[model samples]
Target: MTDTTDTAKCPACPGRRHPRQYLCNTCWRSLPSTTRGRLARRDARAFQRLRELHRALAARTPLAIIRVSR
Candidate 1:
């Protein structure tokens, strides 16, 4: 029998997606910053959520630099 638990495709793209979500990574990443599309307006929260994740990934650790001098 086929595995019925497999996730389904994203509504905006042709990629499998999380069961609880309607968007795949590709769609999430491709979402425009401005709400100019019909789908974008409907999935605004998902787009914003992915945007935050992207931002967090792009952020860097602010480690202090030290120098030892004689």
Candidate 2:
């Protein structure tokens, strides 16, 4: 038997996240387009940028105000 209910908690809200996603749909859509673009990029610095996003979220920064370095 396999567990299909494997989901992770959203960092920004109480919503659940799909295994391969960083945030819930609502929270992901709430982010600014620029930030979203930056986060979508997969490069050598991708993990660093993700950490920046997580740090900002941990600080309770608004999604609109969140910025990840290029």
Q: lDDT per residue, candidate 1, 13-67, as tens digits?
A: 4567776653566655554434223223434365564454344334631111111
Worst 10 residues of 2 by lDDT: 1-10
Where does candidate 1 have its weakest 10-residue lDDT segment? 61-70
Global lDDT of each candidate: 0.43, 0.88
Enumerate residue pairs that collide in model 1: none
Instruction: State each candidate's clash count.
Output: 0, 0
